[model samples]
Target: MLFVRKSYILPTAFLLSLIYLLFSSLPPAPEALDIDDREFSPPPKQNGGQIHWQKGREKHPIKSYIPLPTAAAPLPIPKIQHDFPSESWYRRRQRVNRQTAVKQAFEHAWKGYKKHAWLHDELSPLSGDNRETFAGWAATLVDSLDSLIIMGMTDEFEKALAALEQIDFTTTDATQINVFETTIRYLGGFMAANDLTDGKYPILLKKAVEVGEFLYSAFDTRNRMPQSRWQWTRTAEGLGIEPSRNTILAELGSLTLEFTRLSQLTNDSKYFDAIQRITDQMEAAQQKTKVPGLWPVMVNAEEMKFTDPRFTVGGMADSMYEYLPKEYMLLSAQVNQYKSMYDSAMDAIKDRLIFRGMTKDNQEVLFAGNAQAGMPSKEDLEHEAEHLKCFLGGMVGIGAKVFRRSAEELRIARGLTDGCIWAYDSMPTGIMPEIFHVSACDDMDDCKWDEKKWYRDVQRRLSKGTSAQNAQQEGKSLVKTHGLAPGMTDISDARYFLRPEAIESVFIMYRITGDKTLQDAAWRMFKNIEKITRTDYAHAAIYDVRDRHTPKLDYMESFWLAETLKYFYLIFSEPTLVSLDEYVL
Candidate 1:
């Protein structure tokens, strides 16, 4: 009996030791908290105040995802000069009504896309058909994600989040991927959505990682310069790809913001390193170009040289300049080079590219024009302006506020914004054309409209060649039919692609200046766009903004929802919803 008791005691002691070891290795149970307490609990801080991942589902402040730059002094709050009286009850009601109208417009478009064009890049709003312009990865849905969230469309946002899981970033229908467009529309869309949601949805970041990795493969060259258009299928087959010798400025330079943000989110420096290399190359080449301060539209990526001398703050070169100030803010002003670069470029732009247009009403407004190599004089500038260039107003406005630039900069911003507004108001349909030519004023402040000079200018172009004569005739016919405001010469491109640049500036100006007139302008523009562009299915682009009976283009771009309607909705929203101080948009 004694021997049996000793054996049982030994076995029981061994079992107790094993249980103690197992329990010691496990994590301690969390302190019990009520639902409210749990919901309000702060996330664990890691990576210098960045939110550390916690188990299960949780939401954090937006600053945790996109933290304000702490490396430098915080920027000052913009002193917005309110130009209107305190908001009356009637005015408040009207603004709320407008916000609802914009929301309804969004729902109409979203419903059409979900029903007809799910998983497609765009929707043929008139026909309810799917169009694949950007790899059929559901560009519209992804791009519209943050916008839906901002508008508080909870149901639509949930549905979008579910559909987002269906996208396979590993493959696409297109053989060649446009690096620039995909980066802006897809990669940017994903990052913004994730940031705005405070990283509650992990799938959004996962998909962003997949897409970012795929795009990073484009930088596998000897110089680490990316191929603006990448052929991934060839690369996947072990056949190498090379960066394009000729790439546009925007395609190469507009990637810093997205990649830098990706690195911040994932704690991976590789993505930031890739874009930093590009930024270094650009900084090195800033003064070496034909124009000392501005980069040309076409650049030689292989040699890192500017092959084209033509520069415009419009199409191929706009966003590159845009990203400069934005990246500076995004990095919390840790990089002073961007601010210097932006200042130098803006100085050059004001001196060479910006010109004053003499209006029929004898009003003077600023327009950003084009510059050619070897033509440094004001006389050599192109008086043509594009709808795309209208964003400069907002860009400059933000720069002035952030960089604390001179009051002259703010004045120039207001003038540039007013110029675009005048263009819209002067048009027959109350919508500006894609591109147009205006008469330049010799003196910005003291110029009068000259009918004789306008006729002579037309005749001089007509005498140049038969093609010129035909162009003049076409311009004349458009003028007669559409009724041009004086000091306007011709309509170069009449189509409207549901552009948001003009309204983008209007929105920014409203936020920066607290100008009631800007809102009025936005309201007018929205009403005109809604009335003219709306269809039974959804809104469509019009072939000609001047023609009331213009045919709908059957397609609605992702920006129509992502940018246009978002700007419209925000213009009428509470100013603090997406405060400029808090967001780069």
Candidate 2:
């Protein structure tokens, strides 16, 4: 519609020189455009190594991109930690405090609480005839706790954190012990938020150090991380690598946060170096996993060959990009390539695995490989709900934000907003299901986990009465001991949809741009939670999925849920620099 035909007359030599400079530095643009910016579903073979980005499904199928294996590099990924530069002495004090950091330290504590070793959201909080299993609780807790903390509601947060004090990270628990939380969430959030509350809050640089040391000890690096996702019980210590043992996705993503703090707090290049150690290893691991140049969910420590590709490690991608771009200033040209590759990976996520809006029914139609687009059909309801939530959650959290796809990013953001509203309004009760499988696993054991009784129960439930629809709501009449509501599946993990984690992304969207549309959207969420829902904290249970898991009084997530909700409420109603800066990550 708008074209300008004016051409500046420049010397041929000058024009030629300018063109050369541009091409030398810029990333290559692909010949084809990426699929839709939202609801992008990718098979495992879609993007091994192709960088042009605009190929439809066939252009770049998923395959691992294995870099040549070499001994671990001696240097850690370099850091650009020069301090805030223009920042002052008082601010620095707040950023590095010990005692004054107490306020924030507790926040770090809850981040610890949400880890795999501790009381998960649903099970730990309310166990009895009507309680839930460990996994159910953690999923819920991750949401509730993340939201509550962000909202500035610390009292309840402290209670949850205190609950975690009872568990020891060194011991094996029912669920996987999360090295990520032990390192990143607790350390990163505290250290970053230091003096962040208007210099009123002090930093707990020491606490962050303590957490890192503890994580290093727990991981021991040799044992690798826990075996939950792969379904290996800690008891089954020698389980094979075919299923994942260490969760590198969590491991590396958390490193970005923890290392950022270490670099700032110690002024020690070494602490920051340690972070680079993990990231560089991950980069190399990606290279190792490159079936042609694509990444899979999990890989072995030694071989570098992928254990599985179905899991794409979205969180890993998010954190890597979040820290790397700025970290580019820290590296020599050779190492700086890490930042370049990471940026491209981010572009790839935008290019695929994202969509404007997709119908849950159609997407969850079978397993989760890829969905065309449309709302869930009646037959698809129970499976698609949670899958959509996590998929959208990862995008909203940091992927969409870092990529800076303003319009396209916003569209992906709305997918969550609209999807949730649709789920709540359309579902007979507000309940969402545990998961929607996309790909098929030839091994039945692979499709289901070895350790999780919760998953097993659901598998049994689905198998009963001939099919998912006719299946009797297994475990009806809430088990207060385990907190199993009838219509709901496992409460702990299911609670991810509850609390504030569900809405924090919306708040972030609002915070970044301060768009009224986002705010309005957020307000709609707030009202639905506050007024339309049952209780202040419950966010009002909507469990019509199968049976009555509980009275729906159950709000058993870790704590992120409440923090997220509170964050949205404050930004939506108050809308100020003071409030916004306090929660800055």
Candidate 3:
């Protein structure tokens, strides 16, 4: 009994010693993560401040510009003037509101895309903070940023700028040449936003120049192509990666716009020339077209020259034109030719495509009137998104500058964006579905369920993260309820439209002319989404609160919400906030 007792005590003693040793060997707790009991500062004296507006006010040229030392209006608050701002400095609050809604929806939809680190071989969009994703996400970020600066939200905009810092675009990394979209989306938007925000958040011009140089050097003689994909050839260490062929038109259009923007920012003639080369390439390419059209999505850069006209022309063609006319205005004096081309193109597009509405069954597309033009195939989703982007971009360009679109054109654009929003408002609570394509199947006569099967199939594959079962169910439900050609479904769910691209156009209207309605809209959308805020997958935004395990944040895609929301918040805000106008230009 004594021997057993001794053995047990010895074993227990040994175990206790080991435990203490292990505890002692462990490192101390991290100091950075400590949540200390914080101390609060003393409250300030509430009433002793004297009213001296003159102390803060700078002397101006006119005596009328100066104000007396005392507060100008009621106690505490001065009488703030809401006067007519300069024509160029016009504010678009109404449009900015709608753009905010666009961002809210865009954020939820964009989270489904894969990360760059995952796709080590293929082009990953979310490669860096400037861009983790390619053009699609970048465009969303810029669009959102546009609204953000307008709304007077500097905190969020700064966060976005911080996120962009992750993308280091150096000439040494040849394969890492996806900086073009960042320039167009982040840099350009920042330049414009900084201009609007009183210089609080300008993109560094030196970085822009460095990025522009990288972009300029990448384009080869093969129709001014930028390397879409690249990898180290193992030929040399310092020389960097070898280039892979295939550059998409959509990206090229993106590059062209950046070049144009850089030229404007830097006054470098070379950027203008680089932009011209893109148009030259567009002219060089050939593709099928029913009217003034061309495919914007390039599958095979060498073999396919803008094939599939209906899907491509809307965004790619229009985007290409974005930099061209502006760059032309800067380069040569023949502005008349540019104006003429726009007019001619407008006529062609009006005649060939675009139906005003579907109020009448005849306009419902398919039988003889508007519907007879054939539905888009599953392959055309990319095409449609591109066209939608370009169409909106072109209209904004044309309406804002070219020909000063008739009151009718302005009305049309307003109607178009409004219609898009109304469609989203009417959509089913959760996800937005793919489009209800017009009936154009040649074999429709043989199959009764072509509409349901086609769209259901298309939506599942295209709408980013939707499940196949859900897509089919929605497709069948839409077809069963509405049936055949010309029926309407919640196509607003398309990540392309859900983003703030259209709202950017609306913001243009507000900017060109001071409109308080835009400001009201921006405020309303912010409040609306704020109510819907829910955390998912460790990210936060105006999320689909119903879903769990999806925080729904893609830095690139969410930039639209992050930036544009801030833009709308800034311009109409109290003067105490930081200025954006100085930084953007």
Tens digits of per-residue lDDT for model 3 on 89-122? 2344443445555455434433322232221111
- Residues 18-114, candidate 1: write the lDDT tens digits: 4444442322111223334334433333455332222221111111112112222344434442334568898899999998999999899888898
Top TM-score prediction, candidate number: 1
Scored by CA lDDT, what does every candidate get?
0.77, 0.37, 0.38
Q: After superposition, how far is residue 541 of candidate 1 from its true place, in Å?
A: 1.0
lDDT measured at residue 415 in model 2 versus the true structure, 0 to 100: 52
TM-scores of all candidate predictions against the true structure: 0.84, 0.50, 0.53
Error of 1 at 256 (Å): 1.2
> What TM-score would you give candidate 1 relative to the actual structure?
0.84
